[model samples]
Target: MPLPPDIRHGGNKACYSPMLDYVKLPTPEAFESSEDYYSTTFHEMIHSTGHASRVGRKGILEPSYFGSHEYSKEELVAEMGAAFLCGYAGIEQRTIGNSAAYIAGWLKALKNDKTLLIHAAAQAQHASDYILNRKRGEGEQIDEPIA
Candidate 1:
């Protein structure tokens, strides 16, 4: 399925701008592989779900300092959400290692807090579900907290 019209590409950096209600991604050729391109696009798309007009997650809506807990948590949500979307689309294997490494970096910055990881996973699931047109109760949950 194609992304919503509000999401667009063509930017030096990949980001979801809530103020603009849009997502801007770098060119596909900028990534190491097509999988990387899609994964990065998916990450930004996940960020868009936090817009007040969508799922309304505060992490993306509020101002947050770089490296702050809120910022780190949002990064976790975006990466994990993208990973979930990739897995659902059956492209996860191509990007799983990179996704794991990307997520691990954030985990380290967050001091390896298992509880935060769990919360982020839950939020990511919610965000992915939102993007995929799955209502909260319409499908099986896509992410389970790590034991």
Candidate 2:
């Protein structure tokens, strides 16, 4: 929710703070394109959705170290959720490739468990739905292709 100054001189990452219930992302200038900026914001939004006050995903509620199973799974969900949002907004074409590479990196950390994508995708759909203010059984359709 807040585009705060980067901690590092030119960091290009973002984060969601559960304690403060907010997202902190670098400025738009840090990204190569507007699509990249929005995609990164969406990724952090998905992470925020996992907060205890929202969808209550354990990966976010619990403290999971980097590269841990929970951490990897959560990263996959956030990236996939961002991809879904990008597709819905008709901007996936600009960010899909980066999303795929990001997801692939997390998958590798998860030991390349193909099944995790399925599971993560389901959660991603839920996160995107929540973010979009859609209710369950309303319309589980995605009009745009994710990749």
Task: Name the candidate that leads on lDDT.
Answer: 1
Residue 37 alpha-carbon offset, candidate 1, angstroms: 1.2
Candidate 2 lDDT, 61-141, residue by residue in tens: 889899999899999999999999999999999999999999989988997575887888888998888788776665653
What lDDT tens digits, residue by residue, belong to model 1 across residues 9-103? 67678887778877888878888889889898889888887776666676877888889888889899999999999998889999999999999
Q: Model 2 compared with the native: what TM-score? A: 0.83
Count steric clashes of candidate 2. Answer: 0
Among all windows of 10 consecutive residues in model 2, the one with the lowest summed lDDT is: 1-10
For TM-score, the strongest prediction is 1
What does the lDDT read for residue 119 in candidate 2?
Answer: 84
The per-model lDDT (C-alpha) reads 0.81, 0.80
CA lDDT of 107 in candidate 2?
87
Model 1: worst 10 consecutive residues (lDDT sum): 138-147
